[model samples]
Target: MGNNLWKDTWLMTVRNIKTTLRNPFSFIPNLIISAFFLLVYEGGLSGISQLPTFEGANYLAFILPVSIVSAAIGGAGGAGQSIVKDIENGFFSRLLLTPASRLAIVLGPIIAGMLQLVVQTLLIIGIAFLLGLEVVTGFGGILFVLLIAVGWGLAFAGYSAGVALRTGNAQAAQAGTFIFFPLIFLSTTFVPYDLIEAQWLKIAATINPTTYIFESMRTALIDGWVFWDLMQGVFAILIVCTITITFAAVSAKKAVSRG
Candidate 1:
């Protein structure tokens, strides 16, 4: 029975992908925007590593995780916006009438959104490597990065989608993007946590999950693979995924039942 549900989910996922690709303009802009930011960040950070805290690490290597996190968060918010669009066009209601399981309907948009994230992540990593970022942990480290990226993307998407379902308005759904930006920027992604002067920002960085994600990626890519660090990141990912997915599922069910 579970396998059947997942099979149905995959079919729904494929349909969602087709619907998304039908609007190339809607999807391509995000890739372009992410690429632009990747360039600016890598270029800006390349010259800043002479600072004592960098300790001779390649600036591109240092910033790669930041770019990944940005892309995932952006992609998740984009996914929520797409859900709003579907609601506006009555596509979601149409899906509700179909035999597809509720989980399938909920995960379909998420799967499509993850595909976009994967593309952005690959493009960013390629560009970073071109700028001389080296993966010290080799293939395994690269795999770890990809796993974290996917986990973060899914977790954020679930949270954003839950909010969209509850609000049932595109403009309100967009608040997730605004909320995510400060969280991303205030973390240790751009600057080392220890270097932060403001007590508040320092305290926030210590608590922000993005900091752990960046630290995990940095350790995987540059500092050699450490089991405990990877485990911490994995644990965080699982917790976020569980909470957000539960919220999304509940919200989606409520929305469907109300209709």
Candidate 2:
């Protein structure tokens, strides 16, 4: 049974990739938007580093992880939209009629989304390098950041997938995008935590998981590797992923049943 489920998952993933390639217009727009933000942030606001906590380094390094997260979140939103489109077109219903596991069906699109996000991240990082952004931690730090970004992508994708499955509407599924942006911007992604003066934003940043993620990436990239800080970020992401994936699985089951 486990083997069959694994095989079904692989097949579903392949199908999802094929669909994504066939409908590139649906996903490419989000990638372009994310790339635009990455460029603007790196080029326009990087000079802000001369202000305070960011003085010792270029602000592009600080903002890189945030850009990665943004890319992942945007890609997940697009994937959720694709899921909603499939539902609307009755393709999701046809898939449900097969013996494939509902969890596999839900995860397939998310996996494809994450793959796209990874490609976007690589491209962005290359662009940053071309713009004279230096990676202090070198290859190891880059690998670590990529892993964490992908983990966060999967977690967010799972949550978005759940929303998509529940609503069966692209607009509703896309709403998850709004939920994360504030959480991400309010955190220590662009500026240091100590530099934040706004009471409300400070409060929000303290509770936002993105803060931990940024801290982890910061320590890995800017400073020497710190295991404890990295562990904290990893733990937070793992817990969130577990919860969100469970939610997605349940929602997918329900959607399959209803279909």
Candidate 3:
């Protein structure tokens, strides 16, 4: 059963990737937006690093992880959109009639999202390097950041896939993803936690999972390995994945029942 599940998941993931490749329109816009954010923020906020409280002189390094994480999570909707398309076109129902594992039916798109997140992250990191950003932890740091970013993105991809399974509506699934935009911005996206003056915003950022994730990525990129922060980030990912993946599994079961 485990081997069959893995086999089905691999097949679905491959199909999802090919489907996404054939439709550049689905994923290209997110990359463009992420690139634009990296360029614009690095240029406009170059002065921020000079602030007394800021960690490094290179603003791009400080902000590059934000761009990577944003790009990864922003594109997570592609998985759900694919599921919605499958449902709308009757493919999902036909798929339900097969011997494929239902869990893999839900997980396949999410695993595809994880692979896509890695690609997008590496591309963003490459662009940052071209713009003079350097990681203190070097290649190992890059791998660490990618792992964190992909893990966090997996949680979100699960949320997106859950919405798609529950609603089977592209618009609804897309709308669900938009809810994360504020979560990104409300966190310490623009400044360090200590630098935030607004009490409510501070409270929000303190509670926001993105804040810890960002700090973990920033630590790896600029501050070397900080065990506590990295662990906090890992914990955040696990917490989110627990909730969202469970939601996805329940939604998938419901989808199968209705299908």
Query: Using lDDT as the measure, which candidate wins?
Result: 3
Candidate 1 runs further than 4 Å off: 1-4
For candidate 1, the C-alpha RMSD (Å) to the true structure equals 2.3
Best by TM-score: 3
Candidate 2 off by > 4 Å:
1-3
For residues 29-66, what per-residue lDDT tens digits would candidate 1 score against the true structure? Answer: 76666666667877776777778887777777778888
lDDT for each candidate structure: 0.80, 0.78, 0.85
- Sorted by lDDT (best first), the order is 3, 1, 2
User: What is the Cα-based lDDT of residue 11 in candidate 1?
Assistant: 82
lDDT of 2 by residue, 175-244 (tens): 6668877857878766788888899888999888878887887777777577897777798799889998
lDDT against true structure, model 2 = 0.78
TM agreement with the true structure for every prediction: 0.91, 0.91, 0.95
Consecutive 10-residue window with the lowest summed lDDT within model 2: 1-10
Steric clash pairs (candidate 3): none
Inter-residue clash pairs, candidate 2: none
Which of 1 and 2 is ahead in TM-score?
A: 1
Deviation (Å) of 122 in candidate 3: 0.8
